[model samples]
Target chain A: MPDPVGAVARLQQELTRLPGVGPKSAERIAHFLLSGDRKTAVALADALRDVVARVRPCRECFNLTEGELCPICSDSRRDAGSICVVETPRDIALFERAGSFRGLYHVLGGRLAPLDGVGPDQLTLAALAQRVRRGGVREVILATSPTLEGDGTALYASNLLDGTGVTITKLARGLPSGSSLELANPQMLVDAMDGRRTL
Target chain B: MPDPVGAVARLQQELTRLPGVGPKSAERIAHFLLSGDRKTAVALADALRDVVARVRPCRECFNLTEGELCPICSDSRRDAGSICVVETPRDIALFERAGSFRGLYHVLGGRLAPLDGVGPDQLTLAALAQRVRRGGVREVILATSPTLEGDGTALYASNLLDGTGVTITKLARGLPSGSSLELANPQMLVDAMDGRRTL
Candidate 1:
């Protein structure tokens, strides 16, 4: 009742602000931290402070980094002429985990959501444009999600790069690799049919 | 790859130590923190520090509190003569949420898990005995879970208070309210049958 301790309640309140953490989860986490030794709590606090203090957007691609450029931007092995554009840095991690993409990435910060007042100016679109115009970028792959907002963002981005003479493409849509045709939604089935290729 | 920032990686690693947070979720949370403004991260860090520095076990019942006594212990309207024994302070919150138990609480810290090297000395059982011996407590309700370890803990606690002239009772076991018979496990069915009451 009323939280046995004020500090614990405050910690729970702060924890709820994190993405996907609800009030119940926050309370559980706060109590978990208190139940164990103080080491875990202190370490987490220090880590949070350190991340906030050190991490900043990469100079070239807007990915999170502690220095002037992100790891991909600083690396010479990655293909500089091919850029995989994504909605957020989190998407970059997903692509990295897949380990198929050998090119650098451009984090758009977020896709366009005009109804929520988000527009081209709000994202790092201009920065991306500058990166493309400055040099020898051969291809720009729009790897946004299959949602309507993602499609709209990709369309807007492709239009933005129309006169630049660089090849612009978006990720293909279809039934997911492991999914059954019977379980595929109507839109997915339509996409699979439309994008069918010869073996 | 290898985390864009060392601080972010460390934050992710620290976050994984939190209950139910795996590597993937930790990465997501770490990146989410980085994506947002510094305010959220900073506030969480401060709250963690405050909780660690201020909160302590309640002197009376071992429940978490900032002061010498927990809120329930300090509350004059509660029935101090009747103590509900639970395994953790989190359980106290659960009982409080139910809003039925008006008695004080005694946190046993954890149940009897001898194989895990947790013995009677590891818990606050001695303190609980001291509380019972020092006072006019009329009843000690064993509200530990209805599991093997929980039953062992309750039995041990009951034995400890055998000569104290206090009524020692335990929570009843039965099929949970609203649960269907088909869904009930064999053990639950047995408990329900054995614990049948006269209407």
Candidate 2:
């Protein structure tokens, strides 16, 4: 590619490091930065610097935060006696967006992937167990995604919490609310069949 | 949504401002940056800042360069007498990659679009005309894209240079080497027919 303006090219390169961006997209973005108003570029640059400098993981839930505790963990109105476990903070956001859950959360950092050398020890499993042992927790919801790794992580967590007096529950499965058979995937079919309710 | 690390969230927001990036992709990138080594982020940021600080448009060709003239404009081997006019600097790079042309270039910056209020005066058409009028030039190639606006710009340019004695030519067209005829658009069909040569 023809070398663009130094700053434009530099910004484009940084932007291209993002997933799904190619050289053409990078060039388009660079051109936009060069031709766009000064305020936009400055805002973008400042945002980049600020994100790197200010954001941190919450001490209690591992959710993103600007302070020691995330907003969810600090909220007194949430159900502290029931914790929902997830593999990432994004998952917590998904749940929050659904607006159905009012419980506390625990981010596991990642799921167990033996091929990648990730195990229970590498995750927040021990912390979760400690939290469970400290007691009064009525239920532990396994809300990990339905992927293979997610399922494995949920099963492992369930095993870890066994005999701890806290009831374990997984999210419901069936035909998705508005979908027909024609639109469902193979896994969705199996899950729907496996989770069928009796009259 | 739960706020991620402040730095990470800020970076994600900045990244999403680029064309084609959405929130999910931005989040993926932010996570990648956080998971990556510090050097990578620093290098990316430095590159962005440096590019902005140093790069500028070449005075004569409008191609990107660290100095007033791009490498193509300064190269002794390039044909100073011929200029290839393109809609963008990215086109200059594409032509250079083809490596068949030995002429220098002039970027019009963009094609004319009345709806968007872009017109002849907004482009580098006058500069191109001036270059053609300066005497030794023998040919000017109209390599604008095959779009309605691109054609309009080309015709406008041809009319502007009507008395200049310079030979104007457009790039050739046919079924692109690896592309299928079924996939060819109407404009491509028109160009292919118009550009046909005796077998």
Give every prediction's interface RMSD: 1.3, 3.0
lDDT of 1 by residue, B1-199 (tens): 6454688889988998888788888987888788757788999999999999999999999999999999999999999899999999999999999999899999999999999988999999999999999988999999998899999999999999989999999998889899899999999999999999999
> What count of clashes does model 2 give?
10
Worst lDDT run of 10 residues, candidate 2 chain A, spans: A33-42
Reference-based lDDT, residue A112, model 2: 94
Considering just the first chain, candidate 1 attains a TM-score of 0.96
Which residue pairs show backbone clashes in model 1? none
- Give the distance in Å from residue A151's predicted Cα in candidate 1 to where it truly belongs: 1.5
TM per candidate: 0.97, 0.86
Q: Tell me how candidate 1 scores on lDDT.
A: 0.91
Which lDDT tens digits does candidate 2 get at residues B30-72? Answer: 6666543444566566666666667677899887788879888
Best by DockQ: 1
| Docking category of candidate 2 | acceptable
In model 1 chain B, the worst 10-residue window by lDDT is B1-10
